[model samples]
Structure formats: C-alpha cells, structure tokens
Target: MQSKIDPDMVDLNERHELLYTSSPIAALPIEILSLVFHEVQRTRRATGKPMIPHVEITLSHVCSHWRAVALSLPSMWCVFQHSYAPWYGPVRPTRERLAVYLERSGDHPFDLWIDFKTNEPAYQRLFFPLLEITLPHVHRFRVLHLLSNANHPLKEFVEQLASASAPLLETCAICPDYSHTSLTSLIANKADIFRSGVPSLKYLRMDETSMFGFLPPLDSVVHLRIETRRTVPSWIPNTAFDAILSLPNLETLSLSIELFELQAFPSRGSVPKEPIRANKLKHFRSAYVLINIYTLSHVVAPSLESITMNGVDLAGLDDRPSIPNHVAFPSLRIVAFIRAKGGSHGARHGPNLQKLMAGTQNVEELLFWGKTGIEENTEKTHCMLLGTDSAPSPWKKIKKATLNIPFSSPTEILLYHQFIAAKPNLEVLRVPPRCLELPTFLQGVPPHIDLRAIDESEPPLPLCWVPGPDWLDTEEDPFLFYCRVFE
Candidate 1:
C-alpha cells in the first residue's frame, strides 16, 4: 500500500517552514534559545523577584518552530512558583498547573519556591495536595525556599523534608513571617529534618533565635548570616559556641544583635571560658549594640582580613568589670568603625582604641564614619577617630584613611589638618564637598597628601554597615571619604 500525502497538509507544512525561515529569532539554533531562556530565568531569580509560571508557554507562543524547540527542552519548564492565599479559592487548579510543569521538567533538576499567606482553617485541605505533588520530586530539587506565616502548617512541610532525601539540594532558606515569634522556635526544633538530606548545601540564613536547637553540619557552610529582631538581644548558649568552634572551613560570618532596654546583661558565669577558633575565617562583621565585647573575644580568627563594627558600643569593651589585657587579630588588613557609640569621651575611647589597634598595627585601611550634616558636632566626631590629643594615634602604618564626617565648621576643618600633620606617612585624604571649597584649609595642609572630596552622587561603600537596601536614600546620613597610597 502506498501512503498518500495530502496536498492540504503538505501546503500547511511548506507555509510553516517559510514563516520560520523568514523570522530572524526563529532561525536561531535550539541551543542558543535554551541559553537565552536560562539567562532570563537566572536574572529574575537573582533579583529576588517573583517567578513567572508557564515560562515555556510564553516562549512557545512566538512561533511553531519555537514551540517545538521549547517543548523539547525540559529544563526550561522546571521552575515551579505559586502563591497560596485563602482568598484565591481552592488550590486544586494550581496543583494541576504544578503537575504540568513537573511532567515537562522530566527528571531535570529544578528550583521550587512556595509562598503561603493563608491562615484560614481550610488551608491544609487546599495546600496538602500541592505538597503531595512536590514531595516526590524532592530528589531533583536544587534550591528550595518555603516562606509562610506563623499559623500556617509549616511543621508538616518540614516533616516531609526530613523524611525525604535531596542529594542535589544546594541552597535552602525557610523564613517565617516577622510578626510570629513562636514560629521561630518551632522551626528551630525541627531543623534537623533536612540535615541528612542536603549534602551539597553551602549557604544558610535565618532569624537569630531560630537555630537554637537545630544546626546543620558546621564544616560545610562557608558563609553564614544571622539576623536578630529589634525587640530582643541575640542570646547564644554555650552549646552554640561549641558548634561555631566545630566549623573548620567557615570563611565569612555576620552577627547582628540588638539588646532590649529591659534586658539585663548576662552574668560572667554564663560566658564561655574557652575561645572559639575559626582557622579559615576571613571576614567578620558585628552590627548594632554588642552588650559585652569580651564575649566576642572568644572568637579568634587568625586569618581575619576585615573587621566592621557598625553602631557598636566600644565603651562596653572596657565597661566590663575586668578588661582583658590582650585581644589579637594579627592578619587584619582593614578596620571600619561606623556610627559607634557609648564610649567615654576622654576616659575610655582612647585606651580602648589603642588596645584594639595594638594588635592590628599592620592594618592597611581605616574607615571612620560619623554624622554627616550641616549641624555636625566637631568634637564628638573628631574624638571618635583621633581620640584625645595626649594619646598616641593607633594608626601608625595606616596606608589609607577614610573620614566620612562633615567638615562644616572651622574647628572641624582644623581638626582634619591636625590629623594629617600627625600621620607622617598619611597618603590620601577624602572629605565632604564642603571641605574641598575651604581655600584656607587646603593651602595649609600637607602638599604631598592626595586630597579629594567625595562626590555626593556616587554610591556608598558595599560593606554591611547599613542595615538594608535604602542605604543610598538621601534621607540617610551622607558619608564621604577617599584614599590612596603615597609612594
């Protein structure tokens, strides 16, 4: 029997081929189209924006050839993002949509992000079916993020993670709505659920008090950030210190703790006697008020290169009942003090700075940030950096210095000139725009110094000094500085 080709079908195929050949983008190779899709998805993820469902559907709608190419690539349809809200009615339709993505993914590794906002009693009935579809594909999940309110059924979801194994999982973050404090403790108790599952996990971030009872293998984590709530001080027990000490390969660590007004300081008996040594640690940052600086003395990082203390109380370092004689960071190359408070003006600030800088004599860069406005206090700002005139400046070998403080007053301008004269090896001087116009101030300063005013329109430093993304907002206190090495 001879198969007869219908003239209608043959004509339709010829028209489709003509259209595909005429379109410039449709002519691109399948591999190039796949890379373009991956890059678009990657950029969206990096921006922390919501994901678009049925991404393949959007691309496939372009042309017949594009639809066939998109249907052939499973990874293009792997991302599953859905927001569950009680007001949106039943999630049965959403589950059907999720199944479509899973079927299209076909064994390719995928990323899953689910946001649960419903607190209604019927949420479990609507949400469980979606979880059932997702749990079976855990092995293929490379990134998983579950964000829910305090009252939502997170325990059930966590239980599923504990029971399942995900060898490909690399990044995981579970965050509870900020209003719910009880949920932090609840999640902490069940933290071990994913412990045995995610072997390749590297980055982890969570609320400060949430990881009390649960911790992953410390050695595998290279970067860790712990965020503290504004209402309470971050209280870490002795056992937590033990876990921190066990991290052999940890590199960067950030701790943000704020002490409550009513909270009492911890007794000396509760402080850990032994130091926590992180041999591989490179950068360490402590933000907000640290009740007892001595408590941080326990953390010894020989390889530490940068230290940032923002809004910290340096006076508390000496205010302790008894101050230790020596605290060392031998390899420190950069030290930044921003908006630090609570130190005695002439009494403790100088000695405290000297004690801190004594071990960091080799520091190449020093940054001092102060209030930046027309109504600036010269004495308070100057005292923060140079300390008392009688005391020796701690920065003997400092190659670069950034003074991000206002120089509106003559006294303030003169103080900077005096500072320049003190640092015989001083190379670069960066100041505010106001400082640059002071003709009398510029002519009197050292000629060899590389003096430059900070451009107001430029961006601020990239370090973790500011709390959030609105750091560049004009409402924020402006900071200005510059630096260079004089040969």
Candidate 2:
C-alpha cells in the first residue's frame, strides 16, 4: 500500500483541502445551510416569481459535503412553480427538470403553481405532458394554484382532482385568464370537482358568479372573499345567501361589489319575517358601486365587531328604502365610511346618514371621508354627533378619529375644527398632510389631543397613525405620543 506516491497528485489534493478550509461559508453547519436554501425559496415565492432550479443546483455544486446534505433534505425541493413565459421559448425541457424535483422531494408534501400565458395548441401540447406526469402525485399537494385559459384542458385536471384522494390539500385557487368572460360558466359546470372528501380544505376565494351553481361543504373554511366583476351585478339570490350563511364557522367575510343593477326587491309581504344571523362572524367589509341599501338589510350579524363600507350609497335610490329600526349590532365597535363621488346629496344630510350611525352606537373608532360638496355643510351635517343637544349621540364614545377628506371652503374647515374640539375623551386625531398645512387647522385642536398627519408613502399605511416629530414644535410631550397600525 506504500507504493511511491505521485508528487503531482499529492499537491492537487492539498490545494483542494486548503480551498475548502479557507471558505468561511463551509464552516456553517448543515442545518444552517439548509435554512439558507429555504430562505432563497421563500424570497422567490414572496415576490411572486417562478421557482428556479438553480438554488438547490448551485448549493449542491459548492462542495461534496454540501451536495450530500442538500440531497438528503426533501423539504427544500418540494415547491415547484412553472410559469409560462413566451420569451423563454419552449418549456418542454422543463419536464425533465420537474421529474428530478419529484424524485428528490421523496415523501414530502408539495406546493405547486402553473401559470399559463398562452392558449396556442402547440404550447398546450408541450404543457399537458408535464401535467400528466404530475397528476399521480396529487395526494401530496398541500397548496395548489391554477391559472389558465378557458379552452385549456383544465377540465381533465379538475376531473383528476375530483377522483384523487388528496388528504393533505389545504388551499387551492383557480383563476381563469383575465381576458376570458366564460369563467362563471366554466366553474359552474365543474360543480362536482371538489364536492366532498377533502377534509382539510379551509380558506376559499372566488368570484361572485362562480358560486352561483354549486360549492363544497366549506364547513371548515374560516375566511371567505367574494370578488364581483364590473361586468356583473352584485346580486346574491336568497338561496345563495342562505348557502353562505350555512358556513357556521366562518369568522371573516369580505364582499367586493363593483356595481348593483336595480332588481325588483321582494314586496313588503315577501320580506323574511326573521333576518339571517351570522353568530361567529367578527369582521365584515363591503365595497359597493351604486348598491341598493335595502339589499344589506337582510343580513344581520350579532357578533360583528368591525364594519367597513366603501362607496356605499344610502341615499342614491329614488325610492329610499328603510332598514328595520329594531335591528341592532350590539357588539359593533369600529366603523369606517368612504363615501363615493356623487354619493352625497341633499337627501342624505339627515335621516339616511343619521339612521345608519344610530345603529352602531357603541363604536369606539370612527373613520369618515367627507370630500363631497354636500359634506361642506359640516356644521349642520355632523351636529347630531357632537352631543350638542339632549339627544344621545353614537359618536360620543369615539376615542380615535381619522378625517381624510377635502376642506375646500373656510367654512368647511372651521366646521371640521369645531367637530374635533367637541370630542371630550378623544386621544388620537389623524388628518391628511394637506389638512395640516392649513393656516388654522392646528390652532383649533385641543392641547390634550395628539394630532398626527397621514404619511402619504407608497402602499399608503391607511391604518397607521403615528405622531410625527413635527408635533414637538406644538409643545406636546414627545413621550406621550405613540404610533399604531392595524392588519
């Protein structure tokens, strides 16, 4: 065994050992290296970018020890995203790469996303084969996202998912090509795809029309978001509303209604004797484009603590409908009203707005956007809320208030100043940056109040209220001011 060793070979081995030992990254433990690899994958996902095979490929190439560790960890290679980019040419070669991932992932659950950018027959021919190879592994799919055209072979994929026993499936989002108009019909016909047997499925989001035909039990679903398209009217038939109400465990509900075309409402005789109640619902938000206020009167949640209404028209209807005076939201605490343009008129000044505010008397936080011409008469409009008279005011308990609206006339500015000066226990008041620039805006504020300006940064922090350093110039204690933001 001690034959004359080649001096050249000994020199090469020594050089390799020196390089490995000198590298600082090589000193890290295998667990740390694995975490670094996971972080690379997470960064890609957070940016909504397709997963690249180079991460694991490059890590394994670093050294023999690294290669062995990367190969042994299945979780690091479990997420696969295939984005169809026309500029990348043909994606047929990626199938082989996908196979490598499937082999390396071993028994770990997988998260998969396929984004289809084109519907050409040639491209479909190249893409379907990869899907066929991935179909058998559906049982391991934990999160799946499907984006495709109407004519794509999604029907076959849905059929496979229906029959496949996917016990680990948790979240699934199916979106059609944005330009396609047949989404409702396409989803309606596939009613049986996720009808039963998926026990772990929870979070669900879909367009409003997609739920018109059929839906899964969705008993375990905690959050539900219904997005209404501009092309369709935001009308949920009684049966559909009943179906949504059946989800006993639903905690948060969001309805994004773009527009509401007038439809014949049920006659007084046909109105339900008892309003539907959502006992577990804690938060509710609705964004409307000319909706009938009476339509919302049918839904009543006793446990709701927060309510937000955007662009809702309570006074636009020619035949003003009334919300039953008896209906009360006992647990409601926070309320926000973002009035749409042309939404405020002479008719809304008194009964309409007052009635809505009177229902939520216990609200401790109120956000009001009063930019319309009708709101210029702020003194008379908000007089009911200032607790100036003997009548009980719902806004008396409001501790935090945000006013992100225009003040065109001096009278309007003066009226708003009076409004803020009236709240006795108010601790925080937030206004637009422009409002702070007004000559008399700060002078009207009480010395005890913490006045803050809204920072208009990109991706605006609508919920955050922080006292700026500029507040120090006003003789307010810097330590007493605090900043708070909401999710």
Candidate maximizing TM-score: 2
What TM-score would candidate 2 get against the native? 0.74
Q: List where candidate 2 sits over 4 angstroms from the true fold.
A: 1-21, 39-54, 82-98, 117-130, 148-153, 177-191, 212-214, 233-236, 258-264, 267-270, 289-296, 311-316, 339-352, 369-393, 456-487
Error of 2 at 464 (Å): 13
Cα lDDT tens digits, model 1, 1-487, are 9676554776665666666676787767888988887777666655544444445666776667777778788887887666664433467877887788888899999877676656666666666668778888988888676656555646556666665677887656564433423221222223465556567766665444346333344456676666553354444444454455447767776655441121124553245556767788787665543432543355677888887665323332434332244665778887766554323321224344445666567877767666412123336546545534665566667666777665666776666766776677778766666667778678767778887766534333324423122211111112212121111
How would you encode candidate 2's per-residue C-alpha lDDT over 1-487 as one tens digit per residue?
Answer: 7576455765664655556767997889988988987887566555543334457777776667777888999987787666666543467777887787888998899877666656675776666677777777877877666656544535455656555655777766554423323222222223455554556766555554435332444666666665543344534334444446446877666656532222224432134457667778776655542232433466677787876554223444565555555445678787665543343432234564566667776778776655333544445544554444344455777898776655666765665676675666688887776777777777788888888775544212222112222111111211112212211
**Root mean square deviation (Cα) for candidate 2:** 8.5
Each model's lDDT comes to 0.57, 0.57
Clash pairs, candidate 1, are: none
* Native-to-model Cα distance after best TM-score fit, residue 218 in candidate 2, in Å: 1.5
